[model samples]
Target chain A: MACHELIEGHLQALARSLPASVVEELRDGLIESYEDQLERLGDAEAAAHAAIADFGDADTVTAAFVRASPGRGIAVRLLLAGPVVGLSWAAALIAGHWWTWPISPPLRLAVGLVLGLAVLMLIVAVRERHHYRTVRLAALAGATGVAVLDTTLLATVVMLPAGPSVLLVPALAASVARVLLVVRAVPEMISDP
Target chain B: MRAEALKGHLDGLLLAALEDGPRHGYAVKEALRDATDGKLDLPTGTVYPALHRLEQAGLISGSWVVVAGRRRRTYELTEDGRRSLKGARDNWQEFAAVVSTALRGAPWPATS
Candidate 1:
């Protein structure tokens, strides 16, 4: 491949793993850097070789890009998932006997904590947008909230002999689905950096 | 020189490369090579990540400009970058002095 293409390919592949904005910046930077290399080395093929050799491989640069970028935290996805999963359980509860649904103190507390954290996550994701560490932490908090809620629901279902079947079952199922999504996504968020 | 040898010091060197004025990605890499007298030649692609890291850390800043019909991302050191560079240089001096003394078979407290 030509110098530019080689670098472009490397970056394009990384774009698959990183945020588009980051790959775009790296792409522009590399293309310009390639032209500069041509001027310095005075040979297209040799310059291409030098550029590739110096930049390391796709994997190495991608790793660096992942570390430098704010990460592809599934915050956006998780945020979207939250409402849908919550509604699914709500639907189940309403269908089963919404009037009889009991809101225990712990459930109320869990809801308060999740709402607080979700708001904080939204704030960081918006205000301190470029602060990757803070953003990721906020995302983790969201995931943790989901986990705590899911575990509490599961424990309630397992422990309480007289729990309402209609509401608790659907809530537990929805919480389980959310927990699964969080479980699957948490590693990707934390592992990138 | 191997990039491995320049690890923690590379950011300082990169900031120093832009001490004179802002330069595009390649120019900074060129300046790095020139400043090191060609001993610290690194993979050209690796520089962008480092540049991004520096920019993200607010140590430097970058913007795009068209040059010769192509978009180029040029970088310049921020005030924080300059301050960090000064600190890095002082640290380097201390480390270099110790290493130089050791390499020359001088005692730890040898007088100049």
Candidate 2:
């Protein structure tokens, strides 16, 4: 069997679940396994069958890749939790009349950039267009961005005159929770396959 | 054996596969199958992800190579991988010994 013919169907089945690079690698792997089997089995048809069988089912393989890569999951999670975290901070900001506070320009710009990065991460993670590496990078960037943003925001909140007050409590708690979650996810983010 | 049966030890088995030398993904699968005499016939999906995980941990590294007119990814153990394998070997020996002793001393189960 031609190598491409041997694994084309498998790759197509895996197209949605895995990145292009991984799919390409898997294609090569399947073909190689088929060729090896052919040498032993001495029949092209049987070799193809054995090779695919040896690689296992598409869903099972997809799950394995998903387990190995935390990029998409992290991005989805951060994005999903975004509005709640933002709203909590917003409620506190409004309650405390934060607009009247002397917030630094660069700090605001930093927040904007981090928010933009979060948006980009969402698109990259949800799209099938990017490779696993890009997804991982976007996710890591998103996580790190959120963690820094939360920590910085928390620090600024603490410095305010109404620090730790009832009005600011929700914002403070949200930032702290986000920071903790990011800390726990750092290992998974870096565990690139 | 079932794929789940090899979960914790799969990494160790994969690391051992590379102990002899670098091999491509399929070759590694063949080596394991040969070593276990088909007992280790793994779920085809299970092996690659495990290899990736090992690579992430810095225990193994993969590179592309041309073989017989085709490009393939080959993997080899790193220094860390070697040390880890040594540790795994020692641990497995001790574990197997204890289990062997325990099982050896147990009375045979009566036929159901």
Candidate number achieving the greatest DockQ relative to the actual structure? 2
Candidate 2 structure quality by residue, lDDT tens digits, A8-80 = 7777888766766567667777887788889999988788888888898888787677656767667777788
lDDT of 2 by residue, B1-112 (tens): 8777775788889999999999877778879999989988875567787788788678999988776666677899999999999998998999889889888878766898
TM-score of every candidate relative to the true structure: 0.58, 0.67
Worst 10 residues of 1 chain B by lDDT: B64-73
Model 2 chain B poorest 10 in a row by lDDT: B64-73
Error of 2 at A32 (Å): 1.3
Off by over 4 Å in 1: A1-8, A33-50, A71-193, B107-112
- Give the per-residue lDDT digits (tens) of candidate 1, residues A1-193: 2445666667767676555555665666566666767999998777766666666776777666545543323556566667776776667556655445465777667767876776567445434433445556776776677677667656644664544556566567677877887787676566542
* DockQ for the candidates, in order: 0.33, 0.41
User: Each candidate: what lDDT?
Assistant: 0.69, 0.78
In candidate 2, which residue ranges exceed 4 Å CA deviation?
A: A4-6, A70-145, A154-193, B106-112
